[model samples]
Target: MKILLVAASAALLGLASVGAASAYDGTNCRAPGNCWEPKPGYPDQVAGSKYDPQHDPMELNKQSESISGMEARNAQRVAHFKKTGEFVYDVKKIPAE
Candidate 1:
């Protein structure tokens, strides 16, 4: 019984820690239209982060707003997928420039 209890607790802790590595803070979504696309398994939004480059709408002002912005943002998202092997959400934490 004792061993079983310990094993269960350890397993639960491990599972909880797995998805906690990468998280969005939600501070980026302050603007009116700001938002983020959530990954399949990760949480939709973090407490203090928003405007994830991966999932957020990046281009607002442009000649062809729909076409150009989408193309550029999609290209960037694809590149990110290649590097991380996972899709980024709109609430993604931006890396330091």
Candidate 2:
């Protein structure tokens, strides 16, 4: 009876360990090919800078430009499909200069 109890306890412990390990596996950000590494000195720069604005306007401008560019490309694709009655799959023709 004692031997059976010991074997059961060991099995439970093994399962518990496996569950714990799997829980941590999903937490790794590098699981995907794209992972961001923080640039050196970035934290110190942000800490030292005065708060002129709640957020950086340049960053906002870049985001706005990216959104607008994507919208324009999508519009062009829709227009081409409407005119030619075919989907645009060519990468060269879809990208905006």
Candidate 3:
């Protein structure tokens, strides 16, 4: 009976450790409308973290615009290639200096 009790206690301790290990931290805020933003008066380390979207809204907008433009250009290129089995290139004729 003592051997069985010891075994049961060990098993319970192992299960408890596993449960603690599997607990989640709230760092993953990637769902829709769940983006993390910096809060005022927080610790500098937490406030200045890399994932905060409210740091520079204009920079984010500029980056988004650049990406959108690149994607649009890529889509146009793909459509052109599909229509005419040839790739497109901009061959600028450099003036003889």
Candidate 4:
């Protein structure tokens, strides 16, 4: 009988927890980003800081240029390897992070 009572109490506590969880109206943001319900008409720049990279044309241009440069370098490496049966390696003395 004591075991049954304890189990019933635990079940009631679990249901109460569920009820408490469902009470959230979704405006509040939790640490791990549970920001589902954002306020309507939210501005693109918050406090003069653009968070989304998609909106920044300069950033996109920089990324595209970087990718193109990498591809050109890789193509050069491939061409050199094909012409001479030796792989080219740029031995840069970059410090380990």
Model 4 scores worst on lDDT over the 10 consecutive residues at 88-97
- Preferred candidate (lDDT higher): 1 or 3: 3
What is the Å distance of residue 65 in model 1 from its true position? Answer: 3.0
Worst 10 residues of 1 by lDDT: 88-97
TM-score of each: 0.29, 0.38, 0.38, 0.51
lDDT of 4 by residue, 1-97 (tens): 9999999999999999999997875577665466665467766566654544456778769988999989987877776667767776651322222
Worst 10 residues of 2 by lDDT: 44-53
Please write out the lDDT profile of model 3 over residues 1-97, one tens digit for every residue.
9999999999999999999886855455688568575566555564555655465777769988999988877776666667777677531222212
Alpha carbon lDDT at 12, candidate 4: 100
Off by over 4 Å in 2: 1-54, 94-97
Give per-residue CA lDDT, model 1, range 1-97, as digits (tens).
9999999999999888876754555545656567655565665566445544454444544446877877877777777777878776542452422
Per residue, candidate 2 scores C-alpha lDDT tens digits across 1-97 of: 9999999999999999999986744333765765465554445445446532566888889988999988887888787788778788663675454
Superior by TM-score: candidate 2 or candidate 4: 4
Q: Rate the local accuracy (lDDT) of all candidates.
A: 0.65, 0.73, 0.69, 0.71
| Clash pairs (backbone) in predicted model 4 | none
lDDT ranking from best candidate downward: 2, 4, 3, 1
